[model samples]
Each structure stands twice: as structure tokens, then as C-alpha cells.
Target: MGRIAVIGAGMGAMAAAARLAVAGHRVVVYERAATYGGAVRRFERDGFTFDTGPGLLPLPAVYRDLFVKTGKEPLEACVELVQVDPSSRHVFAEGTEVDLPNASRAGVVTALDEALGAGAGARWGDFLVRAREAWDRTRRPLLEEPLWPNWSVLAEREPYPSVPHKKLLRTRRATTLAEVGAWELRDPRLTALLESHALAHGLDPRVAPASAAVLPYMEHAFGTWYVRGGIRELARAVYERCVARRVEFVFGAEVTGIVEKDGRATGVELADGEVADADFVVAGVAPGALDTLVPGTALRGGDEIAPQRGAPSRLTVLLALRGGRPEGVAHRTVVHAADRTEELDRLFGERPGFSSSPTVTVSRPDDPALAPGAEHEAVTLSVTVPSGLSVSEADVEGVLGVAERAIPGLRDRLLWHEVRTPADFAEETAADGGAVPAPALAAADGGLLHASNTTRMPGLFVVGGWAHPGGGLPHAGMSGALVSGLIVEGPQFRGSQ
Candidate 1:
């Protein structure tokens, strides 16, 4: 059996460790932190708990498959995967609110029409149909399989087939997501709704390709998920599964560098002046961390160009409420900002920083586990703020001001609150500039993705949100699958069939 060493106890790393152990490899995971789960963390105090990362999970099938492939117990048995109904409530700047039903296109369209105005639903529905085309065209290359050697073809060609629209007596086609919103949706609220999906994933609709339609399409098609007792339970479950499969873990073990001999990775050197040799190494971390492990290792693909810089990390606020969470409230509510253009510019343009009225996503789960008693409630507010910038009380106040519209009496109801910024993320996860990797997309001449799972150094593979198929929970899991496939199945390995 090959001795496999995985760095960082992140989802992708652990996912690979579990599958590798199941494949009869002697796997050992070295985590810098005391706990597992990279971005998915839970904060608890006085019986109040809040998910610090990724309030909801989209495309759970990725984890479901991981459980099915590695063990007898299905994902359902490991944790309660609840499908959030009326999936999300969106409150726009114009005071228009729409409660979209989960995985129901007809219902979503109907709700949008009722709230946003006539024809809005039809326009969105049509866009989704077209988004499906993009999803179908790029799914195998983007998610299900490893990037092919001819990835240039995927990069050069845009999968989304934008329809020609006659504007001012001239035929025009959309190249970016913003054009899609303006050309078809034709309404301010509709445009806001469409762009919000992209912003939530740290992508700029103005620059993100039309193929980004797949973002909303994926959510609408598969549905969003929540894990009972917070997402940390998921991390616990995955860690347990790895243990069950005979994988060993050493917490508080930070890897300082990767040892190399004969131009191949031989093992890793720890921060404590110790080295552990292994036959294969799987790294699941931000690009900065990967660079530190291997001093001169450039994570480049076929062209060997410089790696694309990842997007900024998220800013989250954990709120402990004085009153109980009322029933009939949507589990997730998006408080859309009044000025999306300004916000997007600040986030993605030359002026990268905080927004005075940035869009906020508020998650108020009715689950009893989050509070000490029914009389108390726990709430979380998240915004897609820029990474590497210092966030002030004013910035946090800006998020709260928008969120108050959704929460109603949010200021008084907030018994206590704590804000976690990108700086904190850098401390916790070691991502450069606290930048969170955006999910891989099909756009921008290939800036949408990280380097391939396989690196220049033989016996070393990279896996994480910063790697192939890109970020987000599902993408992270898929990265693990790809890495494991390459190691277990050899160079001839294609992705999962």
C-alpha cells in the first residue's frame, strides 16, 4: 500500500484521505489547526451556535456520492440533510420581496412575477432554460471530469450560446453576465436578482462570463441543503469517516515545507523541525499555503503561466438574539443592496474594498440546536466583502443597516453580535489576503479555475477550492474525487464515469 500524506484537514483533503484509505492506502493527515473542516466552522457560546462558513450547501449530491463510494452508510444517516423550502427570500433595494421555492422552476417564476412585476418570471425562466444549456455544455469539463489536455478548447470557446438581441436596430449578443441581465431581464429588480447569485460566490457579473448562468441554474435544479447542528457536524462526520477507514490524523501539526528529491515530492517538513516521508502527497490549501510548502513550486497548468489570483474572502457576523426565532420565516434571506453597480465596482474594480451598502445574506435557521432555549435565537449575517482590506465598524454597520430591512427590529433584537472579517479568515485558514477562492467558472481566458490537480512535481497533487473544478462545497468535494482518481487509477485515469 502506498503511504499517502494529506496536508490541511480541509474538506478536500479529508475527502481524499477517506477515499484513499478505502482504496487500501496508508493515509495520514496533518492539520495545522486543532480541528478539521477548512472553511466550514461553527462558533458556539452559552449553547448558542452559528455556522461560521457557508451557511447553506448547494449540490449536496457531491457529498452524497462521497459517502456512498467510501462507506455503507449514506449521507442521510451521517447527518440530517434538510431541503430548505421556499429556498430563499430575496429582498431587493426597491422593497420588492420574493420567496423562491426550492427546486421548483414553476414556483420560482410565479413568485417572481407576483413580486417583481409582469414578465419578470418568464424572463428569468427563459434565462434558466438557457443556463441549462451552458450547464450541460460545460458540466463534464467543469465538474464531473478532470480538465482535458485540450483545455484550451474549453477556454477559447464560451459554452453559453447567447441569443442575438436586436437593440437600436443592431443585432447584439451578451458576453458577460451583466449583459445577460440587461438584454433579457430588462428590469432593475430582475437584474439585481440575477447578479446577486454571482456576487454571493465572489464573482463579478460585469466580468464573469455568460456561462455563469450555470450558478443559478445549479441552485434551482439541485436545491440548497442545511446540515443539522450546524455545518461543523459535517466536518466531524467526515473526520470520523476517515478514522473509520483507518486513516490517521495529527492535529496541531503544521507543515512548513515539502521535501523534494529527484524532482519529485518525497514528503513534507513540519514546522517543528520534523519530516514525514510519504509515497504520495495531497495538498488542500489556499495557493499561498501551497507555495510555502514547496518554495519554488509554481502551480501552473499546460501553458505554465502564472496562476490567477483568487477572489476576496467573506465577512460574516454572528448574532445572538434575545427572542425566539419565529416560525414561517425563510431559512435564508438575501438583503439586496440599492446600488449593485457601485458595490460590484468596489469589489471587483481597481478600488477593491468594503461597500457602504453592500449586499447581505442573513441566515436565521429555526433549528433548536442553535440556542440554549426556545426563548433565544441565533442569527448570522454574511456579505461578499473584499479580501485583504481592513473592515471597520462602519462597514459592519452598513451590512446591519441592509439586514435590518429583512430582520425588522434587528438592532433591538440583537442581544450580542461578533463580526469575523477576512483577516480572521487568514488567521484561521491561512489563505492569502484572506481571499476565498471563487468556484471555477468558464470565463476570462481561464482565470476562472486553479491549476490542475496534478502538478509539475511527480507524486504531488493539489486539491481544494483553489484547485480544479474550483471553490464552493461541492467543487471542493469534486476536487478530492479528481485527486484520488489520479493517484489510484494512474496517469491513464480519466475522471469518474
Candidate 2:
């Protein structure tokens, strides 16, 4: 049995540790923070609980598979996973509102048509059909398997099969997400609805590849899910599963360096200067932090995809309301921006800053555990913003204003509000400028692809959001599976059967 040392107790790292332990490897996790679950954190005050990251989970099969592979208990037995019907309500700039049903294409199409116009639903349904094509084309290489050596094939080819548009005398296909929205959807509201998926990932739709269509398709196909208490509960279940499998966790023990001998990673150097040797090492950290661990060694080859940086981060506002959450309210609502051009420019512009009226997502869960009783409610408002910005009073106020569209009398009902910014993310995950990583895409000349899971040095591998398949709850879980497969079954291991 090989001894494995994992750096970080994040979701992906913990998932890998649990599987490796079941495979008969002695695995140890070292985390800098006092607890596990890097970005999946919970804040509690006066009986009010809020999930500071990722309110909803998409493609829960990833975790279900994790639990099945590592332990006897299934994921459903460990945590209460509920499918949120009327999955999301969209509040457009022009006051048009639509509540899309969970995992029902026909229902979503009908609702969009009824709210927007006669033909709106048809356009969206057709777009989803095309989006499904994109999802099927890239699903294997992007999520199920390790990033290929000739990943340039994915970069060079656009799998999205965009409809041909005749502009003047020439025929053209949409390359960027913006083009797809404008040419295919052909409605301002529909365009905004499609782009919102891209923006939610901190990506500028105008520049994001057409393959980004998979984002909305994945949610529409698999449905949106919520844990009974908060997303942090999912993290808790995974951590406990790891412990059940004999995976050792050392919290508050920061790994400062990677010990190498004869040009191979042998162990890790903790902040206290103690070295724990292992047969293999897996690093689940941001690209910048990973670089600091191995001072001078170039982790990626010149021809390999470079590590992604400067991605935008999220600004979340947790509101404690005095009123009970009304029955029959949608679990999530997205308030689109008033001006798309200005919002995009400010977020991805030369001088990056907050939008005066930013697109905000308001999540109001109908769980009694989140509040003191039936008398109070906990609401979370999140917006994608440029990374490394200081959160000001006005910024917080603007977010509240955007949220007011979803929750009437938001200011009056607000008992107390807390702002969680990129700064908090930086402290928790060691990501530079608190930049959140987006999932890898199949096009845009490979601009959206992440670094390979395997490093240049033998016996060293990367896992987590910054690695192959990239970010989001499901993708991170898949990364863990891929890394464990590579180590347990040797490098020839392709993916889960």
C-alpha cells in the first residue's frame, strides 16, 4: 500500500482521501484552516445559519457516486437532498418574470412563452436542444476523463454546433456566447436568461466560449438540489465519510512546501517545519499557492495549458429577516441587470469595479433549521464581481437594492445583513485576489481549459477547482475521482467505469 499525502481538506481533496483509504492507502490531509471544506463554509448567529458559498447543487450524481464508491452508505442516507421544484424564478430588466420548473424542458418552454411572449419559449427550447448537443459532445473529455495530452483538439474544435447566421453576404456561426444569444435566441430577455448562466460562473459571456451553453443545460437536465440545512451540511457529510474510512485530517496544520528528492515529490513540509513522507502527493490548491510550495520547479510544460488566473470572484450578502418565508415562493430568483453592456464592461473592463445595478441572485430556502423558528427567514444575495476589490458600504447597499426586486420591502424586513467578499475567499482558500475558478470549456482557443491533473514531476498530481474539469460542486467531485483513479489504478487509468 502506498502512503499518500494530500494538501488541503477541501471537498475534492477529502473525496480523494476517502477513496484512497478504501483502496488500502494510508492518506493524510493537511489543512491550514481550523476546519475542513475550503469554500463550503457556514456562518451562524442567533439561530440564523447561512451557506457562504454555492447555494444550490447541480448534478448530485457526482456525490452519490462518491459515497457509493467509498462506503457502504449511499449519499441519500447520509444527507437529505431535496429537488427544488419551480427551480428558479427570473426577474428580467423589463419586469417580465418566469418561474422555470425543475428538470422539465416542456414546462420551462411554456413558462417562458407565457411570460415573455408567444414564441419566447420555442426559442429557448430550441436553444436548449442545441445546448444539449454541446453537453454530449464535450461531457467525456471535459468531466469524466482526465484532461487529454492533446487537449488542443478540444481547444481547436468548437463543439457547440451554433446555428449558421447570414450577416449581409457572408454566413457565420457563433463563436462566443454573446453571439449565440444574439443570433439564436433573438429576444433581449432570452439573451439575458442565457448569459446569466455564464455570468454566474464569473465569466463574461461576451468573451466566454459557446461551449458555456453546457452550464444551463446541465442544470436543466439534472435539476437543482438543496441540502436540508445548508450546502455546508454536504461538506460535513463528506468529511465524516472520510473519517469513517480512516483518512487522517490535521487541521490548522499548513503545508508550506513540497519535499522532493531525486526529482520526485516525496512528502510535504508543514509550517512547523516537520516533513511527512509519502509515496505520492496530491495538491488541492490554487495555482498561485501551489507555485509557492515548490519554489523553482516549473510544474507545467511550456506546451501545456497554463494555470488560469484573474478570474472574477463573488460578493454575497446574507440577510436575516424578521418575517417568515411565505409558502409557495420559489427557492431561487435571479434579478437581471438593468444594462447588460455597462454591467459587462465594468466587471471585465480596464478599471474593474462594482456595477451600479448588478445582476443579483436571491436564494430564500424554506428550511426551519436556517432560522430561529417559523417567525424568521434567512436570505442570501450573491453577485459576480471583479476579484480583489474592497467591499464598501455603497456596494453592499447596491446589492440590497438589486435584491429588493426579488424581495419586496427588503430593507424594512432586514434584521441584520453581512457582506462576504473576495477577501474572505482569499483567507480561506489561498486563491490570489480571491478569484473563483470556472469549469473548463471546450473552445475559445483553449482559454477556458484548466491545467492538467498530472504535473511535470512524477508522483505529484493536482485536484480540485483549479485542476482538470475545473470548478463547481460536481466538477470538483469528478476531479477527486480522476485523481484517485490515476493513483490507485496507475497512470493508465482512464476514468470511472
TM-score of each: 0.98, 0.99
| Highest TM-score scorer | 2
Clash count for candidate 2 is 0
Residue 91 alpha-carbon offset, candidate 1, angstroms: 0.6
lDDT by candidate, in order shown: 0.87, 0.93
Q: Can you tell me which runs of candidate 2 are displaced by over 4 Å?
A: none
Q: Hey, what RMSD does candidate 1 come out at?
A: 1.2
Summarize candidate 1's per-residue lDDT along 259-377 as a digit string, tens digits.
89999888989989999999999998888888878868648745832455667779999998888988789999999988887888889888797887889999998699999999998
Clashes of 1: 1
Poorest 10 consecutive residues by lDDT, candidate 1: 301-310
Q: Candidate 1, overall lDDT?
A: 0.87
